[model samples]
Target chain A: MSPSIMTKGAIDCDIHPSVPNIEALLPYFNDHWRDTISQRGVHDLQTIAYPKNAPLTARPDWRPKLGMPAADANTISTQALDTFQTSIAICNCLYGVQLLMSEDLAAAFASAVNDWMIAELLNKDPRLRASIVIPTQNSEMAVAEIERVASDPRFVSILMLVMDEKPLGRRSYWPIYAAAQRHNMPICVHAGSAYKHPVTSVGWPSYYAEDYASQAPAFHNMVSSFICEGVFSEYPDLKVVLAESGFSWLPAHLWRLTKFWRGLRAEIPWVDRTPTEIARDHIRLTLQPVDAPPTSEQLERLMDHMGSDEMIIFSTDYPHWQFDGVDVIPDGISKELATKIMVENPKNTYPRLQ
Target chain B: MNIQLMDRVATDQKIKLAIADCDIHPAPKSVPVEIYPYLSKRWQDYMETYGIIYRQGFPTGPAFPKGQPNAARRDAYPPGGGKPGSDLDFMRSQHLDANNVQLGILNPLSCGQGVQNQDFSAVYCNAVNHWQIAEWTSKESRLKASLMVPYEDPSASVKEIDLWGGDSNFAQILLLSRTAEPLGQRKYWPIFEAACRANLPVAVHAFGYGGAPVTGGGWPSFYIEEMVGHAENTQSLLTSMVFEGVFERFPTLKLILVEAGFAWLPALSWRLDKLWNRMRAEIPHVTRPPSELIRQHVWLTTQPMEEPEPREHLLDTIEWIGWEKLLFATDYPHWDFDEPSRALPIRVGKEQKEAFFLKNALELYNLN
Candidate 1:
């Protein structure tokens, strides 16, 4: 049962529509790459980001008997869209296409994944929208993929992982940012890493739990990179969304960043405003893993420090096991705040949704 | 005469207010020269010739450069023209005498902790400890030292802890936030064990050369990340220590996280507890909830304090983390140093304020 105060027709900003396997995308690929992939015996190009056996990778009820969880569009539509009464569900595909070492192979895989998503999932639901996945290994190729896919209105945003070879705000990635801005696309940075480096600063963590929680600081570090490297100042219109990245750490993270920016603004002269101001204007986060105290009353107290209502967009993060059955919205969110998060915020964030 | 008596009583109360400053950074007046007296001629020559051994990434300056010059406040520079924290008389007048800081703990950062030569690290760590004794702690009775250690080498760290051996002048053992590996790895377990035996709580201050990327994902593009980024290291080490069962292995061992922000603690604990509840089977040693373990073992110093907007939200976070676990710090001489009088934005009651600024540090150090 949905909460009594649930808002109907809400926009679900994040929901993973599983790619069944490499075979699912085979039809989308050209014969040259398809034949090569088959001969090379490259069966699964998956990252440790969401281990298939990890319970968090799928809610037990959502998993099918035969195939991967949420592989069927109707399953997601019924479980995520219909169950929550959401009108729009943005499908964030976590296929690990970008993890390929060869830039050409990665770009080819990205194109194939986008094509497969369109024919498979978006075609089935009018309410579905998606983000274009890019191989960050080559920004030029990544840009070309964005240019190729931008014409479709259903591809509402662009997807980048929080952890990759380098910080997303580096100058090498600027060309892709320019393309994103041109298409009026928000770069959706989801909580997954290429695992090119250790999961935490000291070194690799032993448990999957530590690696999962490490995403909060990883998101925090990228936000600092974005603000200090003048990403916002250079593009002016570019927006970044942190999906499945916890927000409870954000208030303190921003406070620390804003303090340093004030003291050290002269070093990065292009960062004309405090990090908090820049983040409020340019950055947004998906609402999952609220990561607050148990009570909604306490969550309100924690969220009051976020400084703006518009920064959070609603998301169930379906099939991720972030929460239990049907408790999509955490308790203690006021009805007015819920409306803003579910309806107004997502619309304002993604202009395509309007 | 009646008015004069009341004024004297008020003055006595002001004088009676004890301010134990936990995180005071003391710099050597001159790098090699100041440490020479403690080092023997062989190591002294080695120090002069070789200098510091760092990688090509940051051979000359910091790889992650601090924002300000010497990472210090402009006014913090001594009038006599040394680094902000180098001169003793200047520090006393500018900070301690000025602010009524009665109990100041010296955490001298230039102890050659990052010098890649672990042998020199042991040599220089000993030199730095002696330098603290002669220059700061021994000279001023109100000031105390954190026994410096070459924490990169676990055996060296234990040696230094044993050398100081809970000397009255040194109140705690000083390790850094970043290290060659996570502090809890079995390699560094001996340091925690030694600290407990010496009856000294270990204070993990905010900066070091960990030989790994400052961030988990790799090097960030900017310098600001260096300032707030190590708190992420603090977060990692806390999880590492607890999950590795370091706390369980050494029950009396305590940690003072200096210059590591406390506002993030409640949220981090919540995340760890969630994992502990589900993944306890993977690590059978961690018997209780992480928050309970954290509250029992960890004490956080407030420096470069987090400034959440509407300010009062800090109160809610502090409530969750527990106010008693906080030790007020100045991070003196650093560019973003917090002043005790106005450090906290929220209203703290008189009794609790006393605990925050004074009693907490004293009790933690066993000084009171």
Candidate 2:
């Protein structure tokens, strides 16, 4: 499998491949399940192909515009390897494990999507690397899927959406992180459609703008829960990347959490290192929504705080609205930071790419 | 002015010497109805529909209608909203003589942006609140203020309120309007509890927009749409307090509503009286008509006054809502700020005017 023309010079950190057609993927899901993929119009690939010229299918009166167009496997791989000039492409999602394991049958969907994704994407191209999706809805299945895919050279990391129902740092999720640690795979937590539960314990919000802004607090809680839960302390080798999430809120979040930890340090005594130390040692963040785009002042501030370029990773979140581009990166940041985010940091995190 | 001291003594029997000006505002630069000539055009038709006829420099007649040029910026405060009588500097210029006003409450026009933008729209809100507090409130002790919390999320609102509620200059927890359910609704309880714990008074100031409409009508495209939500928010807030049992639960809690004219109290009590007799089974938890609880726990500011009715009706409106619960404010810089010296008399006699102007406000704000 040769590197395609799209992988011309740099590595592509974020790419999406549509899972086998939505209908075809349905039978592979477990029984006692509802078929929401088709009902939700998740497989409108043709309309996505030529968005500006495409005719509007869903009535404006019935629904708000479904945000971003879905991308198929071929479209994803070609863009990453050829158009982006990447030596390696990290395919973050085909079908997340939570969706495929619709009912009580988690093991079946976990194994099925794993096999289907590899055959359709990985086996076809060596330049492409994928995250092994584990069935987060079912614990045993989640561990089993990671173990089965652990030995695959084409697999790079373990992927899951940030869920509010259980903090990723809880004992319930330690096994998944432990498995990633054993396999030398980093953990990638990406943003998803709103959670099945209210994103907060509170009731629903009144508008879409409310929904987007709420993501920051939930993200803060999940990270703190991870820290206080001792997920980082227990698995020192595990590297965590908050994927496709904006990074601007980082300064305030770190400040608040660190400030609170001062008075409440007794409860989480196992966390011997300071929160900032833990963040620098085991965590990396991908810049999207370009929360704090690089400018002379912003770059200076971020560099001063995070201390190294390795803490930042460049991600386009391609096929998603609000994608950050190379041009948006501020000119004042040293080329060294750009090289690390654009090339070195990603390569080092997922050794399969290296 | 002498009656103000007598009534303050009558309400609580506690006597104190400190003088507090409960409502004082450093108004912003006015949007010259001429500079953005379009504002006058857009707002004019709505003004006329409400029967507002204009004086050359000011909107002279009617409670809500009519156009008027607000006073030019006097020597002290800068050219902004508010007529000469209502400007902050005007109050300061007379501060030594007017009840020796020791502290003035500072409320800014820009603080209304959250309600104007759908509350939790962006990080811009956090930045906006930060700038307002850091820049404006730093120098003035007279400006004991309230921090505006974006109401989109109860958690963010709680977080911010708890974070800044401790600032010495911040006096109250400001929310755009009351929640949809009564105050006891658990969803809103977090904000109440946070405010209670901080010992900060929770205030609901009516804004010109953003609420479920009173009638089945969608939001009107014209600015006239504002009139719809003003009273609607007041009624929702009153229902939340009484039926939601907020007063019963947090007896020590203080809630104030500003810019919501106080004239509606008597009529609302009558309506509540009819509803409680007819609908007790529907809201049995409310041991009394909603008005009984409102008069005990709620306070409203007086601005946008109606013409002089009989002294008895004026006394009836205040007595029905509890005279101790009325606060006087010159809604400085808003389109409707009435001069304290003028708006005060048209509604009540000299003695009652003194109570509304200084005594009630001082007690409500906990200023001696």
The lDDT leader among the candidates is 1
Error of 1 at B241 (Å): 2.0
Per-residue error for B108 in candidate 2, Å, reads 24
Q: Supply the TM-score of chain A against the true chain A for every candidate structure.
A: 0.98, 0.80
Per-residue error (Å), model 1, residue B186: 2.1
The local lDDT score (0 to 100) that residue A298 gets in candidate 1 is: 73
Off by over 4 Å in 1: B1-17
Judge candidate 1 against the unseen true structure and give its global Cα lDDT, from 0 to 1.
0.85
Which candidate gets the maximum TM-score versus the true structure? Answer: 1
Positional deviation of residue A33's Cα in model 1 after best superposition, in angstroms: 1.6
Instruction: Give the Å shift of residue A107 in candidate 2.
Output: 4.0
DockQ of 1: 0.66
Which regions of candidate 2 are displaced past 4 Å?
Answer: A1-8, A26-70, A94-103, A293-296, A323-330, B1-368
